[model samples]
Target: MKILFVCLGNICRSPVLEAVLRAHAEKAGLDWEIASCGTGDWHLGHGADPRSRASAQRRGYSLAAHRARQLCAADFRRYDWLLAADRSNLAEIVRRRPADATARVALALAHAGLPQPLDVPDPYYGNAEGFEAVVDLAEAIARAIVARDAE
Candidate 1:
């Protein structure tokens, strides 16, 4: 299975999720391919935010190699699933969908059973605690994906 995680800028939440889910899938022995992208092009090719990288490292998930990229039409055809970080991102991705694309798109948290529809708040403008919270939420959702894939 191929899964793509999406967020606004791809520097914080999405990259963290990509690492977390990839690690879990590997440990579970699942043949899953994971990648992350952003709805916006502002941070393309940039590494994840420093705070986000630090927070993920604290939990043993490395975001060092992740580079932000914008979501493209090819993504819809390449991935089996496109998981958005929040509703806004979700909507943005949906708006970009090609008429012939068949990939399934949904909120990443919701796919993980999170009840909220809002996007994971951006931690860029916030403090370390905010980045930690983003990690916490991403970890929870990644575990949930692992569990679902196991079943």
Candidate 2:
């Protein structure tokens, strides 16, 4: 299976999710493909935000190889699932999604079985603790996805 994570910009949240999920899936012996992108063109081709990288690395998940990319038409059909970091990104993705697209889309937190307030908060403008929260959340989500896939 293939999965794609989406956020406002590719440099922060989505990259963290991508790396965490990949590590979890690998550890669980799942062969799923994972990637991330943004709804906006900003930061395209740039490396993941430094704070996100550092935060994830502290948790033993590496964002070292992540590069920012914008959501493209092809992504819809390329991934088996397209997960949004929050409601707004989810809305934008659904709005921009092609009618013929084949991917299933949902909020990442919700898909991971988290309760209401299903959005994964953006940590780009926040303090170090915020990035840390994102990493924490990423680990939880990675385990959840791995669990679901295992079943």
Candidate 1, residue 139: how far the Cα is off, in Å: 1.1
Regions more than 4 Å wrong, model 2: none
**For candidate 1, lDDT tens digit of each residue in 29-77?**
9989999999999998999998889999999999888899999999999
Q: For candidate 2, lDDT tens digit of each residue in 1-151?
A: 8999999999999999999999999998899999999999989889999999999889898887888999999999999999999999999999999988999999998888875558889998899999999888888888988998788
- Model 1 / residue 30 / CA error / Å: 1.0
- Clash pairs of candidate 1? 86-119
Q: TM-score of every model?
A: 0.96, 0.97
Per-structure clash totals for the candidates: 1, 0
